[model samples]
Target: MTVVVNENRNKRARVASATHVAGCRMDLNVRDFAPMAADEPALAGGTDEGPSPLEYVTAGLAACQLVTVTKIADAMGLDYTGLRVDAEADVKFRAAQGAMSPIPRFSAARLVVRMRSPEPPERLARLEELVEERCPVSNLFLDAGIAPEVVWAIETTG
Candidate 1:
């Protein structure tokens, strides 16, 4: 796979393109993946065809965390039968609504990671720490002054 590097030395360049599809709706494509739609809610004059941009951002963070956790677990030889992640974010739309506000678009976010594993508590704690430290999307939230609350719930397995 080809990698593009931006001025930020530690970051890799990722590109996505969007096409406007009527009021508050857009068709977006990333890499070679299937096309996806992004739309605002009906209240925001959209058709509500797909998730809003903010929703996509929140889901991206959750997906990133899950990917990071799975990679780390495999590297650590941690065995798990199942894994799930639930994510939510608090958003302030004043800026998006054409108002100048000091508050950020995403005020905060929460993540609940549930895993069924035979690993010990210490091991699970270590996994959580590493995920928090390594997940790039999570770091993005932090860099934007939004500290995400991450909870790890591990169910011990035989």
Candidate 2:
């Protein structure tokens, strides 16, 4: 969520996100744009109308990985026709609830990318390496010593 302010002459990119309570849900607005609702399940006390905060974090990481991979593939001229990314995070519930641990965030995260392409395996591997080095979301976890594991499943299709 980067926005370049061309009129400011500094050419700085900033992300503006705000959230407010909308009944039993939270409405998140980015740059005064589309609003997404974040809610917990009935078991968690709120209506199960939208994804939870942790789920949104996982989704953001997955989406960031996809974008990074796509950019790398495009730069390398890889002809990938199909792409799927699945991401999940393991959080310490006890820590979140102040029951234990040092942090309340994800302890670990994983990403599985399935790609359909005719590109060589070596090229795909290099692309993966680049994505690992460049993805901001992945780096956030990596810098924090979470060290997310990324698995690539490349399948050639006609």
lDDT of 2: 0.81
Q: Could you give me the TM-score of model 2 versus the true structure?
A: 0.81
Q: Stretches of candidate 1 above 4 Å error?
A: 1-11, 95-104
TM-score for all models, in order of appearance: 0.86, 0.81
Checking candidate 1 for backbone clashes, the offending pairs are: none
Supply the global lDDT for candidate 1: 0.86
Give me the runs in candidate 2 sitting further than 4 Å from their true place.
Answer: 1-13, 22-24, 95-104
lDDT string, candidate 2, 1-158, tens digits: 13233587567665756475764588877776788888977876678778988788899999999998887788777899778899989987543345543444688999999889987778777888788888889998899889889998888766
lDDT of each: 0.86, 0.81
